[model samples]
Target: MTNVAKARESAVAAETRVEKTVLKVLDRLHALNARLVALHGEIKAAQPVSSGSVCLELYPCGPGCAGCPHPRWVKYTWTVETPQKPSVLLSINLDAKERDPVLTLARSTPHYEKTAELIREAKSILLERKKILASIRSLRNSARL
Candidate 1:
């Protein structure tokens, strides 16, 4: 019932709350790190080809072609190497809408790119979470003083 006793009780409660919050943050960071590892493995397994890089290029109709039906066209090029054979360059233009063998890659390529983007976003979030946890720890330290 004394003033000093009440202040001590309140401080203890606040410390407990901060500790719980820190535990929650640590749990989330652990989960995120696991997800990051799994995503990396999936991306590696989903490699489009043994060895190749996908490229996207955009070409404008032209400076004078103001009324061109197709102002711009998208092209995807894949350079792959086959066993016991020279490297082959495969190219496809989206404007034509013609189906090509490489069209199959279109699906997987986007999935791969999207997963990569997700990984980047997750990494950024992980860094932010770490910063928040650090700040919380600093706050707790200052409170102890």
Candidate 2:
């Protein structure tokens, strides 16, 4: 074959390889986006009911220490009620607590709010991934490879 023909063949082969590689990347990106969506769903499922508001209160250190000089330790709790079972009480002591006089952050176990934020973040990522996949498909189609 002429040198010009051989160069054209090499260019075509290179273009096809590029297209295939891009298609694989697009597939993987699409798969990851799907996984992210599924993860977001799972996180949302762990969300607690909005009705069960958490309560925080201070309890006495002891009867002897009615006027305790030290700062009061707060208790955090929430109740879940269902017809099928007795009411359930859930509580957790926050880790890495700041010794500020007012520890309002520990007042609630609002996992739903945090999980909702995560769901939003994951959905945004999934949206961007889908956009990238669309752009890749557009490029592949435009290139006619």
Candidate 3:
């Protein structure tokens, strides 16, 4: 083959390889997007139960109290109900009657588990796409010579 024909063949081969690599990367990205969407849905559907008992201890005589001359302490016990078989208890301390505290519990429920799995799968796909991109870069560099 002439030098010009050889160059044209090499260029076409490189183009084909690059195209294949791009398609593979796109497929992986699509899968990752799907997994993220599913994970988001799972998180949105999760419901947590916030119910427990609260106790208040009042002291009638203290130097800091403006009117009653006493200090009071409040204690709250909270439990989180998960989709799993068991529930967990959360303990909180309240300083004053005017304070209403909000607490969040991060537990592994069924939805959480599914979300975690989807995240893992998405990460794996991302890693795969990264490797493919690296391979394409390597091919392009080699073709430049």
Candidate 4:
């Protein structure tokens, strides 16, 4: 093969390699974005109290007057209402020192950190790919001359 032909082949091979590398980097970025989206869903689900708790409606009558016109013994009903505010409920039987499991899980998960690092790396890779592609285009133009 002629020297010029070999040089052209080598340049084309290099450009192909760069394109493949850029595509791989973009695929990795896409995977990272999916992971971030999943993590966001988990974070939202782990939030305290997705639904409300049960409430009691109490009716009090005259003290110690079981036979009074207003009977001391009263009947009450339980109802469920959505919590308008944030509050944590602890069972009477559980130890007060128990830690929150949801919080612990969220804090320990590496998804957030990994997502941030992936975003930075993806941005850098994209920028580098753009530059390399421009160079490849220039080479093709020159080859046409």
Candidate 5:
């Protein structure tokens, strides 16, 4: 084959390879977008009835303090945020109020944790999508197509 024909063949092969790569990148981008939508939906749907943090607090007393039998108690504080009301702090003492329903529900439910995990996953996926797009742009510029 002549030199000109050989160069044409090489260019056609490079173009074909670039086209294949672009298609694969597009497919990945579509999948990532679908996953992001699902994650956002689930995160939005999750509405915690009540959520709080529990901690054990020790009183300022000596080892032999006759004032109180127990110096340490579990303190439960909940922060509730909603469209109607935001940042409503609810305090519950498990040591004193053992029958508190909010603490009980919060202990048994993992809504907050799951929502946080979903959000993190969504963020990583978004970053990945952005990187993929940047790479695709570079590929196009390099290929001059």
Candidate 6:
């Protein structure tokens, strides 16, 4: 296969991975929302309770973080929501560790926030994949220039 084929394959794989991750993140958000909805019933009069932990942050590892020789870094963290307060980041690290329960979301961790973030990430990966695929197709369709 040519370099173009390799690029297409890699982009396709990356797109799949990003899509799957988005689903997982959305699921976590959904579960947290459900917990809060239930809590709201009993705590209708009590102060809102919330508790969730943050996993970690992502930082650029290379010069630009979006090209070859550079790696995009994601800081892993686990968060659990509390009674009324927002979820708190319990642990954080460079590597992703499934230490804490994810279903629990802190009330503070707004569902919109996580969903938006995941959507943005998924879109970005998909866009990159589209660009690569488009270029390959263009090359295949065009006559020798």
| Winning candidate number (lDDT) | 5
Residues 1-145, candidate 2: write the lDDT tens digits: 9999999999999999987987887676757655664654455354443433222223346664312212122224456667887765554432225332123332356564555455445546545665665776677679785
TM-score of each: 0.46, 0.43, 0.40, 0.36, 0.52, 0.31
1-145: candidate 6 lDDT, tens digit per residue = 9999999999999999977976775565445434434432322222222223322132335663222211122222446567887755443432244332223334455453553344344335434544544554565569443
Q: List runs of model 6 lying over 4 Å from the truth.
A: 45-145
- Best-fitting candidate, measured by TM-score? 5
TM-score of 6: 0.31
Question: lDDT of candidate 4?
Answer: 0.41
Residue-level error in angstroms, candidate 5, position 107: 11
Clashes of 1: 0
Q: Write the per-residue lDDT of candidate 4 for residues 1-145, one digit (tens) a residue.
A: 9999999999999999988986885575455444544444443343333222111111345685221121011111233445775444432211133432222223344454443343334335434545554664676679874
lDDT (Cα) of model 1:
0.51
> 10-122 in candidate 3: lDDT tens per residue?
99999999789778766765665455455444433443333332222224565642223122223334456568746556445554444432112223443444434443454
Candidate 5: give the clashing pairs: none
Candidate models: Cα lDDT each: 0.51, 0.51, 0.47, 0.41, 0.57, 0.42
lDDT of model 1, residue 55:
25
Record all residue pairs in model 1 with backbone atoms less than 3 Å apart, i.e. clashing. none
Q: Which stretches of candidate 4 lie over 4 Å from their true place?
A: 49-145
Q: Which is the better candidate, 2 or 3, if ranked by TM-score?
A: 2
Over 4 Å off in model 1, which ranges?
52-145
**lDDT ranking, high to low:** 5, 1, 2, 3, 6, 4
Model 4 TM: 0.36
Pick by lDDT: 2 or 3, better one: 2
